[model samples]
Target: MVSYTGAVTPGGPAQTRQAGCLTITKLAVDPKMSNNAYLLQCTETDELVLIDAAYDAPTLLSLIGDRSLTAVVTTHQHWDHHRALAEVVAATGATVVAGEPDAASITEQTGVAVDRTVTHGDRIAVGTCDLTVIALAGHTPGSIALFWAGSDGQGHLFTGDSLFPGGVGNTFGDAAAFESLITEVSRKIFDVYADDVWFYPGHGGDSTLGAERPHLAEWLERGW
Candidate 1:
């Protein structure tokens, strides 16, 4: 089994956990930046897709090893998230997937065109597994999250700088942006997913809907 440590951050050490069938390996590409890059693999087929190629292309490639990297899904077009995108794609020839609205910007920043422009509710197939795209705009005009329903009947959400453990991601002090983030998260994520649904954010640690559900009112009251 591929060991998955809990989310890695600048100050925290790595820890491991096991999720059946679906193997999620979280790598802190750059500690100073606290940028996270995830490798989501279908254990049965060994087909994998990388989420956010933050930094260290060589290291990320090494982690992928002999497994075929079918795709590279950019949760958003932020430079910090795709710094190593070009290099990784060059090395692995993985198809680049980006949000439709952000596709042009992603290509502009990384110099690699997006092969697939995914929108909210679009499904991306990876071997035997599938990822449902959920547009969670706020941090950016085209920010998105990918929902993977595991064979065990559990759900895993990859929220790219949109939703986090403590509160929603930073909106640069924009009240409307914050409102949009909270509203979309509540409706698209919290409302649809069950309590046990675990979410892997763009940076820092992982969280569950159940854990963050009770704190919604507090989050709103605190205003991020």
Candidate 2:
């Protein structure tokens, strides 16, 4: 079990960590966009779930070589987050899952239908391990985060564009949207989870809830 820093760069090798009974692999894809795609494999069953097929099919496919890909879970409807979606599904035949609100938009843009539309409290299993869906509506009508409460004290969260290291995801100057995102994050995430929980964002390196919790008030005041 190698140490998981959750640090990766475009074209660089992926970082894999053993979290409880799960094998988590984080890879930064799309050289220019710097998008990230994660592979969550259940160590007990070897069943895997790919979170956001953001880009670089060759790299993603290579990382998934010989493993069973149960499904591809798209965090949101963002174009950057699903660039490799159509291709990956075409190649692997894995089920496609997305937030119900944004599933149609994602299908419209990517030309691949979503097999399952999830909402808050929904659970998607990765073999023996399960990922609980946390809907963070703001960045998009259906932005979401995946929560895995590992047996270990610290849990793991896979936040799409809705939450990040420094602040919440971009709302594009829309105060209402920003409010929705910040409020949802503060209530559904910061309030619910403890500090030790690690969160992997749509892009860039990961951060723990504690590290970003202190900045919530500042983020709301700044209002990006």
* Local accuracy of candidate 2 as per-residue lDDT tens digits, 1-224: 55779889999888998788888899998778899899999999999999999998889999999888989999999899998999999989999999999999999999999999999999999999889999999999999899997786669999998888999999999999999999999999999999999999999989999999989999999988
**Model 2 worst lDDT run, 10 consecutive residues:** 1-10
TM-score of each: 0.92, 0.98
| Residue-level lDDT tens digits of model 1 in 107-178 | 999999999998899998767778899998888888999998776888889999998998898888899988
Clashes by residue pair, model 2? none
After the best TM-score superposition of candidate 1, give how far the Cα of residue 76 lies from its true spot, in angstroms: 0.7
Q: What are the runs in model 1 whose C-alpha is more than 4 Å off?
A: 1-5, 9-20
RMSD of 2: 0.9
Global CA lDDT computed for model 2? 0.93
